[model samples]
Target: MFKKLKITCDEATTICDKNQYGEATLLEKIKLNIHFIRCKICFKYTKQNMTLTKIYKGHAKSCKELKHCLSDTDKEVLKEKLNSFKV
Candidate 1:
């Protein structure tokens, strides 16, 4: 029954993280899905985890396509500003 398939919140979170990395087994995923049916907090955590993963992936992909480098003058100005902030 569903009771037999239930997993603890800690285990669920671990499995959720593994699933994010494509490392979870089919049985672990099944248990996680079953756990999600009854635990709103775990469900929310999984949703947020997926959102963060997507955001990070998007940022990483975009970063590869964009290049930003400071000129020597800009670097000198930054160094002076940083020096002024020193104790």
Candidate 2:
């Protein structure tokens, strides 16, 4: 029952966020696993956080591809036109 987990809910949350970004250490991930096993709330939060991160990552990748679809010259021309319209 989480006796060896040695992590608080806040720490679990931090670890979950770090795990999403691939920054969590193995030790941290182990601790998070223990915490999630004992804490339904933390498990739910972790699941939701993972879902949102995936959605956001997908959107970001698509946005980057869309932006690159425009050539550099087209971008420069668009930027100049936008600047001229700025009142």
Best by TM-score: 2
Clashing pairs in 1: none
lDDT of 1 at 9: 97
Predicted structure with the largest lDDT when compared to the true one: 1
Q: Candidate 2, which segments miss by more than 4 Å at Cα?
A: 1-4, 66-87
TM-score of each: 0.63, 0.67
- Model 1 global lDDT (CA atoms, 0 to 1): 0.93
lDDT of 2 by residue, 1-87 (tens): 556768999999999998999999998999998887789999999999989999999998898886437889999999999999995
Candidate 2 has a TM-score of 0.67
- RMSD per prediction, one decimal? 6.1, 6.0
CA error at residue 22 for candidate 1, angstroms: 1.7
Clashing pairs in 2: none
Give residue 68's error in model 2 in angstroms.
8.3
